[model samples]
Target: MSKSVPHAPTSFRELEAPQRKAFFAAWLGYLLDGFDFILITLVLTEIANDFGLSKTRAATLVSAAFVSRWLGGLVLGAIGDRFGRKPAMILSIFAFSIGSALCGFAWGYWSLFAFRAIVGLGMAGEYGSSTTYVMESWPVHMRNRATGFLLSAFPIGTVIAALAYGVIVPNLGWRCLFYIGLVPIALTLYLRRSLPEAEEWQADVGNRRNVSTSSMLFASSRRLPNAVLAIGLATALVLIFSQHTAGYGWLLAAAAIAGFIVFAVQVAGRLVPVMLAVMATVFCAFLYSWPIQSLLPTYLKSELGYSAVQVSTALTWAGLGYAVGSCVAGIAGDALGTRRAYVVGLFLSLLFVFPAFALPAGNVVLLWALLFAMQFTSQGISGLLPKYIADHFPTRLRAAGLGFTYNVGALGGAMAPLAGTTIAGRVGNLGTALMILAGTLTVVVAAIIGFDLPARIGRAFKADDEKASSAMTERNTTRAM
Candidate 1:
């Protein structure tokens, strides 16, 4: 995506020392994003009880946050392009950390809802900044592995949330999880003090035509607006109420939304087909994927009669799997070709994972085992995107492009809980509700069939690698002289 990116060192071990610091900052920020989201998921049951919310209403709070994410991605992403990734990342992290802390003080459903929306805005910004910064800084050949490693850190947050809920909630209560959000502010300060912009990003800023994101999206034919509205409507409905019956209403909603999206995507193809494909892929994948973290804690407790520690342990194992899967996915994507790794590898893994949800009571070993495998496989798909998106979009608009695509897809899939929980509510089987969404994986696989993104970027990567390597060599020679 970066036209003037410096050449990669032959191996990741040779990555510029400064880039490693940028990567660490992005990784920590993403890890906190994971911690914040899953922290809320783990405590949803308590939040509902505290606020006298129906399952749907509680999920609505999560839903509103998802909807706001697109806007956050757009706004902050543009800022990353205009100001610098470092500044954008710093501001975004602070906003979310403060928002997470404020969530602890929420007195009612509306108050929490509002705070989460603010957090959502920050979350979107973090996603945009982190994905853009890390992918842009790395060598193209190893982008998948780097992005996967970064993406994997997110689940670690979920794992931490599970542990915190298990340990802190019993002793300190649910508010403590929100309070924990403030701790990442330390990361914000660290980033401010140490983080640097990628050389490619620096190169692009000098001569890029800067346009507002609003102008681009509003004028980008049906590509942006159509994707946003069609997906938004369906997800909002599912989140607000599944009383029309969980699976039934969602099926219709998905169908109607799909129809609108299909029509919108029929436009003449663009250079960034990978971006288009990923946006579609994530929208479908996340429908089932996210709910595993967002709703499973409550589901395991309510239906399976698990104690707090059991839920925590099960999810922790799953989170470990998620971490492994994300890392493996990147390497696998590079090995098997990103297409097969995601479509086939991730899809087949999801199939095996479905049975875990239906586990009978007291089979703790099997529960944790299945959950571990499922998360490992299910999570692998997410690891591929940062590299994929970076490869497709131009450097100048990279953050906004990645941000919009990621959040728009997230917006579509945002109703996973509303839809999944509603089915669980109706049929009284959380596992089965999850099984119903397994078909979404097919949509993800199908979208990737036409992409040969690596081929498209090969020349650019080769050129940039040589150029960057040359520049670095020159700098060293100058110092020696």
Candidate 2:
């Protein structure tokens, strides 16, 4: 008997009805996640005034959300890998929505901190499942564009929050802004009823069942106890740091020590070098991004003295730039390689920061233009991350692996708001602080992605090869079925 080649969609237009449906559902999930997440940023000033918070204290709330994000990613990723993507996605959406709604009920800073942590869990959880689901559903050839379009929802979601801020916060107040989060609860039901599980996940389920759940979760039986130890120590250390007024250095050090223990135990040793490089890249990536995402509004309103209307207008322009950059990055990733796209995008972003931040605030047109360029390069490159990281793992562990690497690396982001504010206080200028901090991190990311670190470490991108093999196997299996 002869083997048949499965037909693959070469373009988004060619994708089947189910494939498109899954993509849209995942897109909406990510979009709402973005909306909920950005609400904090938009309302940071209001929340601060209402609660009498210092800049540093206000930033800690952002860090608090980021610190707990890894937990959501880890748990939900495992669930998605083991049970099904559809359920995982739905669960994450529902989780975050509830978290968002709870924020309205917060009576104080501590109450709000705890509530936002819940939102963080849900937000990170949604990313792991939704991205994995959409990637598995779309054709491999078009995965870059598929993931890009999916992630564009993030910036667009921020724009929606900005618009909502202008309309609701001015009239109904910031609490009502969060109350709108409950609307996504309806989306979860719709997704559960309409979206089917990814075909690739369905095909792998039988084989995954043959393997022990323990091995699947930890990568080896020998690593189980060590993994548990690492998780416990890390969790304790992070919680302690998060609850206190710890400095960014202390937080980063605590996370580093915990990460080292996990590596020493040989957890997922098969992807050790790649994982390290990715974690480093992700850390730097977060450091580069969070300053803008978490602090830009504060900078504009406080440092540059922009009015609320001006702040929202500038952010909307930045959001538009982010959306355009995301689509362009997808095209670049497909045309070039993922690493190439990352390097160029990150480098350009680094260069644009001077004009974006250091320029005189009096030039409103020029300021908006510069902001667009800054976000276009910096935020747009984020579109590549979902496919770039997801491509490094097998279907059975796709969610788990992606979640672990991405969210763990996101710990660096948790430190960024505090880091940025600290630098600004010392230097007495937010623009200079942005350039110093974000620029340095951007360079580090460019070096890691642009250079052949894998080859120097003796792997020569083994993960990419494994990913290709997995894709071929999945296609063959689909045709056979």
Candidate 3:
């Protein structure tokens, strides 16, 4: 029997009603995922204090969450590909909401860690489901922009978390944060009520009667691209985690070990002078910036001697800056080629990373500027990685391929804190640790350029779309006759 091939949407408004509804549902799901993920970062110290755990222990708990998330992404990606996007998304939301709420009731470190890990599992399902849903629904012309807009939720959710830390955390406490994280569950209801399953998913399922989920993801035709994309994504994730883990001083020894290993190998090469300069600037920024965002309450209680309210206000600004950066990067990424956008953002980040670290302590304006620039560049560049994945694969195996690649990067990100913290411990300066991170960013930039991502991405996207279009037309004609 011939299949009825659906026409792809031509413009933003041309997106079918079902597709639009699915996009919004998936968008909100992602936004909440972002909120739940970032909320933990803001309240890490408080949670550590409540559990009477050391920083290392707390970092371990966070890493555990990442590991669960990585597993979730792999498993859910395959599931979403097999079952359908809507069901996978609904299940994901249920898992994450329950996990997040459980976090609020944790009585000890182990319980809290377990709860957070559950949250990660829920989060793992989100990106793969949402990315596949939107990619399938939108026209190719608008795919980049739609993907960028969908991802902008990450920063927006994070910005909201910043506000919660500044305003809600003071009034309610850490437990309340988890309670607030439950808001995303509402999105699941919206999904069930409003969103329709993609026609593509329905058709694939109907045609491939006996195919197993694992075979669908790793079948010979799909396996090679999946492995290569996942590895590339893993490398990017490593870069993100290295920067974040170092900046926050999450894992001193690991960061140092990694930095020394890189440095000893003379990885900096001809870029050493530039890298050093960037590192110096980042160090100065870190001195001024860290206290406001990472240790805001401590800064208020100890240094500036302000009340909790004042401390919250300062942190909110930092979060807002982070959110703005993410949004701008997403929008910009669609307009510029993803590769060019990322390279520009990374270079700008290198420029800002040093200055951010160099800013004098207690300089609020400089601190805010550095945070805004750093996060804007960091999250902004980071946001483009997924879009690259989406562009690289076809609808049939997009979720598994995208998820595997992206999560491999996420696994790398998971290792960042350990690496960063270790380096800071060795160097005896948070600023120096950030300097090392900037140097790494420089290396990533070179790799990105040298990698020739534009040509690679363009070829993959073009080939897949042509095949899909031809197949779709054949199916449509067969149905008509």
In order of appearance, the predictions have TM-scores of: 0.80, 0.90, 0.72
Residue 130 shift from truth in candidate 1, angstroms: 0.7
- The sequence of per-residue lDDT tens digits that candidate 2 reaches over residues 1-481 is 9967657667778889999999988988898998998899888888999999887888777876776676777778778888888888998999889989999999998789888888888888898899989988876767788878888888889998888888888898889999989989999989988888888788776346533222544555645665676566456535553555255556656665566546422423466567666667788889988888889999999988988888888999899889889989988898898889878998888768877887777889888888888889998988999888776567877786677678878877788887898898899998889889888888877887778464344266454555565567666755663
Per-residue lDDT tens digits of candidate 1, residues 238-318?
343333444576566575555434432332023334445556655765775776657788788888889899999988998
lDDT of 3 by residue, 357-457 (tens): 56655676666666666766755555555565554344555565556445534543455455455665798755556567555745554454447543344
Report the CA-based lDDT of candidate 3 relative to the real structure.
0.60
Please tell me which predicted candidate would have the highest TM-score against the true structure. Answer: 2
Name the better of 2 and 3 by TM-score. 2
CA lDDT, candidate 3, residue 243: 42
Kindly state the number of residue pairs that clash in model 3.
Answer: 31
Sorted on lDDT, highest at the top, how do the candidates line up? 2, 1, 3
lDDT for every model?
0.71, 0.79, 0.60
